[model samples]
Target: MTDKKMNFEVSKYDSEIAYLSFPAHPGKGKKGIVMKQKELSSLIEGYKGPEVYLDFDENGELIGMEILL
Candidate 1:
């Protein structure tokens, strides 16, 4: 298992919902995920800050984070 981090942009967001995406994809359209504030905060360990990317492991565990302002 390996940890991975990818760059993403804040495509759309509101008080409760956020959409993240990469500008380019290999025929997969846009690579992105839609998450609620509750779920995102949990992955970020309750730290409310400007986050530009996400970190997860092969087992799909949220293990690390990066704050790209």
Candidate 2:
């Protein structure tokens, strides 16, 4: 991954969801974290909890995560 800054943003509606974005590789759409920019290639359940999901890019690099709140 490029050495770009990452950003975080939460939903305005009662903070139901949050987004972590990689500005270096911006994508299109909004389904979750990765979906907020890049297209989701695959999603893996986070070991920490069921509400956490790890998002990956087409190359299999971790782009961001989504946590249900």
Candidate 3:
């Protein structure tokens, strides 16, 4: 493996929602831009936090994350 750095964008809206987006893979055209609470259980085992959500592309690569603040 080669040493590489990945760039991400973080945005907070109205001090309510914090979004972390991956610039390289936008995850557009995916079923759901943000995974639902029910979906989170299967993806992240033992994670019981309701404030975090994730976005994945068709290829199952994590592309974004949404956190409620």
Candidate 4:
């Protein structure tokens, strides 16, 4: 098996919400996921930023998160 790097872009929908977008490519298509303000806060125990980092598996699939906010 080989590790494939995943790509995602972060954007804030509001002061209380944000989302991640994985652009479409060849065999894959566009996809997105949202994180609520409450969820974000709990994740980082006070996460507040305009950007965040995401983690994925060898298959290039989102596993949860590692927010940088």
Q: In lDDT terms, which candidate is top?
A: 2
In the range 1-69, model 2's lDDT, one tens digit per residue, is 666788787877758788675654365465443433322233443434426556676566677766676
TM-score of 3: 0.48
Query: What's the residue-level lDDT of 5 in candidate 1?
Result: 34
Candidate 3 ranges with C-alpha deviation above 4 Å: 1-13, 27-50
TM-score ranking of the models: 2, 3, 1, 4
Candidate rank order under lDDT: 2, 3, 4, 1
Which candidate do you rate higher for lDDT, 2 or 4? 2
Model 2 segments more than 4 A misplaced: 1-3, 27-50
Choose the strongest candidate by TM-score: 2
Per-candidate Cα lDDT values, in order, are 0.39, 0.58, 0.56, 0.42
lDDT value, candidate 4, whole model: 0.42
Would you give me the overall lDDT of model 1? 0.39
- Model 4 pairs whose backbones collide: none
Candidate 1 lDDT, tens digit per residue, 4-59? Answer: 33444332444433334322222224233222223345556667765534444444
Over the stretch 5-68, how does candidate 4's per-residue lDDT look in tens digits?
A: 4444443453433434333222233254322222344468665674454545445654444344
The Cα RMSD of model 3 versus the native structure comes to 5.0
Q: How displaced is residue 42 in candidate 2, in Å?
A: 13
The backbone clash count of each candidate, in order, is 0, 3, 0, 0
